[model samples]
Target: MADQRQHVQGTLSELGTPLARCTFVIVDLETTGSRPGEARITEIGAVKVCGGEILGEFSTLVDPGVAIPPSITLLTGITQAMVAEAPRIEAVLPGFLEFAALDRGTVLVAHNAPFDTGFLRAACGEHGYDWPAPTVVDTVTLARRLVTRDEVSNHKLGTLAGFFGVGAQPSHRALDDARATVGVLHGLFERLGSFGVDTIEEVRGLRATPTSAQRGKRHLADDVPESPGVYVFTDAKGDALYIGKSANMRKRVRSYFTAAETRGRIREMIPLVEGVTAIACGTGVEAEVRELRLIAERKPPYNRHSRNPERSVWLRLTREAFPRLSIVRAVRDDGAPVVGPFRSSREAELAREALHHALPLRQCTQRLSPKKTVPACVLAEIGKCGAPCEGHESPEDYARHGEAAREAMTGDPHRVVEALTERIAALSAELRYEEAALYRDRLAAFLRAAARSQRLSALAAIGHMVAARREETGWEICVVRHGRLAASGLMPLDSDPHAYVRALVATAETVPPGTGPTPRAHASEMECVLHWLDAPGVRLVELDHPWTCPSSGAERYRDLTDWDRASPSTTRR
Candidate 1:
């Protein structure tokens, strides 16, 4: 034991160069699953190390109580039977937190920090421990930076141990992985001289705070309206990051960015986020209508459903040579009637799963292996899809069934679902188990969406629509006139949404394609005076909330910058 301690001291001293004054708590975990939130840790091991010395180490096995998956048991060599008898996380957490908070402060270090820290935080929350979220250093991240391409076959603790010429204890156990991570840290220190790892304070200083955004929202100078309109999120460089809609501009605009999904990305983004501007509408209904249009115009990355994902080809679902689902850029408006006009190709594919539940439809996306010899898709055998992929069903026979599906998804959804239930009983009587299952799942999602859907049939119809989600710098406008796309324009919008959208729509005939139009153009000034003469019913909406307005209220609009180019006397409404 004394010899092992000396050897460990010698190894850790080498890391002295890269890590200046910082102390680190080396940690490891055996988790029940890969995802952070749901998974429970079965074991935890950690050690406090500083100035080339091991101050202390703690290791404990936890009774997760939940039966471990077989694969996880094989990897960790800890069976459900072994953990079944161990102490709970609550009993083990106090000792763990004690070691973690040792010596004033220490950053946690782990081979795969996310795996360890995720489990640790989760356990702390479960046990009600005061684990003030700790800063972490990933040895895995460090090894990637330090290790040469040929030296390591993989970055797992076993592979990393082999590269550093450090032998690991029984692998997969939390204590062993922790030992391996410490070895990697020592190896990196010897290889790269004097690399500085920041203390928690220094690391946290890199984070961008939400104060600026809060201040921007609460700015006394902003012109806010109670109506509906669009809002623009922009970076310091004046690049549009996101575009959103709100009905109550005062309340809805403030609700955006409730919290950053990922702190790392948001921290990097915070200092760069400069301001947000809003457009106001008279009602929530109008806001929802315009929100879809604005999304098609802007194409913001933050807004996934709104942006057109590339490589996403819409399934036309044509009655073609394949007699199955056919891929295309848009849903076919060709002679063969389309079953769906889905928002996305992915959603269209997922819709297949739900379709079987909602409607009695013959479905396929395969064009390979001739019938009789060809085996059905796994989904077909498992009763998730109808086995039409094998050419067992003809388009003429399935046409009525397909029509029911189209109604459920794109048209009269109520009638579509009601029609499918009657058909499922008939298919079951015919012993078509595969056909029944497909309709079962599809109907479930359709009903769920329908139950949640407050949509009254497309009342104020706009023409063929193509929309893009807005980003930080400028807003986007996708114009579809009479069921055909006129064009798309990206334009900077005013914080006061009522004035902004009016300016945008009134001058829609002039802005250049691709990017947003210049703010405060002379043509816009001339058009606003003549705005009511054209389309007077432009609308605004707030997202995830029930507020809206028409573009009619005078108090609903305000321009932040007062440099107004007055409308000439010749301009008449």
Candidate 2:
């Protein structure tokens, strides 16, 4: 037991000053107004406490050198007459500063600290005194961390005082409130004991009030390392319940049981969590990709994304005698120009509508042979389509529309964007607002899909690549194979990066070339890779192909599409 206590103390010493060895000055102020520059202190009250024992007290009234408004007098019960004969802030400031002794490494305590400290700092500045800028702990923040709404109505000092049955009751005066806050602070300290928080640093770093279940399960975090990694929460049967990654594995795993983790699904999964598995990595991107891969493979109940990458739908121009646009769940090697990996079928349909609006593509969801004629649909009646199904339009003529649609998806979208924008303008001019809005949605969806497809294809076409970003600790290096993260490592600062890069490349996952824009990687995963590539200071160390996107791509239509969607008229319905 003695060894355990010594071990705990040694651990905490590295964290911060222990509460038992620290002195705290609990302060409260009655001000003429809220803003620091706009208001002056009417009264100041503080109690200095170390280990729950009051060491001293400081109280004073200050003449604001301005008339106290009736509203301020009503709220704090400090009238102009009360402070008219009191010492001015310049006179009262030094005595209070001396009594607080914050410059001697004492922690400052206050309820909603910014208000009181702001005024104090302003007064010191006005009086030509340097502000100490001591470590501040807000009791209001601590109360919210330890006490839940079930125990107290709010985090206000008065509410907490009543909840704790503190001897002093707050009455809008400075001294009474400061005394009441002392009891509230002690009560919060007792609650912190259950979470193993005894040091001032732990108190300052406390996140949220953990539920009893989460508190009981806190032991699960005992083995998690303090490093960048992926973590898995497993059930009694050893099946993964949730998967996540963080720069600090231990801290992130611990947060699952804290109030900082407020996701309803995660809270529900916590009780079932029987164990935690940690996979330490050399860099954040490596951890991220590992988490993505694990979640995709396990399809954990609490993990939402990358689990069903196969469910993504795409707009495909079918390869046939007369090709027609169709929404497909998977792409084929038939070399058809595809538009997406759209998250939902609805988005693919919207993109399809936008293309149909510009070109005379057949809306019929069937194989149309150039040799056999079929009945036309209503789209043909309205001239929205050229009725190629009836052979009224030759395949050569229909081919022009199909080629234009393909070009819009894979290359410059100017033709489709220009045609749709013109139609939107014409509709808005005629006050056919709803129809114009529908067209606007379709255009935006098309542009969004086109931009993503172009970006993904540009990267996916590359055979092999290596990139590095300068980080504080080292150079974050990643090896990419067809837009998938194959391997990643951090080259230690001041070390040889070429050798490390070679070693990482040699051990990377062997990736065979895959078909289509996203290849073997999920679109979302490729997007994450793209995000890392786009960050500042990222240098391409090696590449098999030129890393570039089409200069005439749909990216140019982004602003106009965004503006059309954000227009006030379209937002109403």
Alpha-carbon local distance difference test for all models: 0.50, 0.84
The clash count of every prediction, one per candidate, is 66, 0
lDDT of 1 by residue, 1-573 (tens): 001122110110111212556678888888788976676779888777776677888888898867788889888888887887789888888777777883355778888787777777777777676567766777766666666568777677777777778766538888877777777777765654322222233222222223444434445215556555666667666665666565445443433322211235443444555776566643332344345455555665455444542333333345544334444553333434332223345445644555555544445444534344355767666665455556665555555666654444334555644555566567767777566555543454333332211121111123223333343555445433222223334445456644554554454443221211111121111122123112333332211223221222111212201101222111111
| lDDT for residue 281 in candidate 2, whole number 0-100 | 93
Q: Which ten residues in a row have the lowest lDDT in candidate 1?
A: 1-10
lDDT over C-alpha atoms for residue 68 of model 1: 84
Q: Write the per-residue lDDT of candidate 2 for residues 1-573, one digit (tens) a residue.
A: 001122110110133467888999999999988999788899999999998899999998889988999998888889988998999999998899899998999999999999999999999998899999999989888887778889878888888898998999999999999999899888888887667666776676676666777888988999999888888999999999988887767876776676545667878999999999999998777777788788888999987666877778999988876788899998886778998777578878998988987888887888888789899989989988888899888988888888888889999888888888788888888888778788887888888888888889888998899999999889999999999999998898988788888999999988888768888788878987898899899999999999887899987777755744376475343
Per-model TM against the reference: 0.33, 0.75
